[model samples]
Target: MMSSPPAASPQALLRRLLSGVARVFVVPVSADGQLLLHRHESDRHCYWTYPTMQRGTMRTDPATVARRLLREELGAESGVLRLVHVLPAARTHARSAVYAASLDLPAAEILAAREATGTSRRALQGLAVTAETLVALDVRPLAINDLMTTGGIPARTLLALPDLADPASTVNQPG
Candidate 1:
């Protein structure tokens, strides 16, 4: 009979867990200055959130992971994605990385693509909201808002996004 392996120490276990888990949060912005938020039909815990994804491997570039998330979640990829901020493992559950991408397409198109592709784990409904609307709603996973505001992430990186600021011009109306 084969001998059983020794139990892993708590530190080793934590290290293993941390190394295996990698998550990515994507902030998709339309040209009109709207932020894309997604909610799964089955998700009763949270109302909505920025399209979030899991990285396949730790070795994968964050930008690459963000791009894959865009393709998988939105079903369209024509934007320049950049790593805006990274929440270290100590701060986040799974060493989550946050990325921002500017999409030329409107929210409607992105939603249509999501529906057609059906790639997400659950049926996703995308809502495009202005910064003011988002703040007023008080969406779950407050980290998203924090990330935009004073979440320690660079302000300039997200300043370009109109949604991150006060409501200025109405681009894509919230759905």
Candidate 2:
């Protein structure tokens, strides 16, 4: 059999494949000013991450990735998600899409949905912290403005927060 093409040098391979890598982060914010965070059992008591999505080549579709992340981590779907920002991840070429969804939905409803769908309820075990607690917890603050300037967010789309008020009632009440 003919031999495969000669192996490419690490630099050459990296140069050729550099255009394909990216990182997407989702940030959820509640109207009460509490920030939704994911707490891993690792050394860091808590940090911010959207969901467990493939980091490299698997991150091809941003919208699909965003929708999947909300469902997997927050147990909520995209019908009411608010796009907040898209920011770059430090110095890496990767970027992140930040989103904010209110905790208007009752915890009980959230629980029932997760159970009924056979989804992992343990993903968001961390306590939802207000903006103040986030500082104390040493978690990095992600902002809507930062994501907009990094070329991470879609240029044509203006990220806006949805008025997720209950349709049944004119007044927005706690769900």
Task: Predict model 2's lDDT versus the native.
Answer: 0.47
Q: Which ranges in model 2 have alpha carbons more than 4 Å from their true place?
A: 1-21, 29-34, 42-60, 91-93, 102-104, 115-118, 126-128, 140-175
User: RMSD for each model, in Å, please?
Assistant: 12.4, 12.8
- Go through the candidates in order and give each one's C-alpha lDDT: 0.60, 0.47
Q: Can you write out model 2's per-residue Cα lDDT over 1-175, one digit (the tens) per residue?
A: 9989999775564334333436555555443333445555567564544443444567365445666776786677543454344455565335554544445554456556776886775555334443344434544433432332333221212233332222132323232
Give the lowest summed-lDDT range of ten residues in model 1.
Answer: 164-173
List model 1 lDDT by residue over 64-142, tens digit each.
Answer: 7778888877776846565545566664356776667777787777777677767675545545444555566645456
Query: C-alpha displacement of 113 in model 2, angstroms?
Result: 3.7
Q: What is the lDDT for 20 in model 1?
A: 43
RMSD of model 1, in Å? 12.4
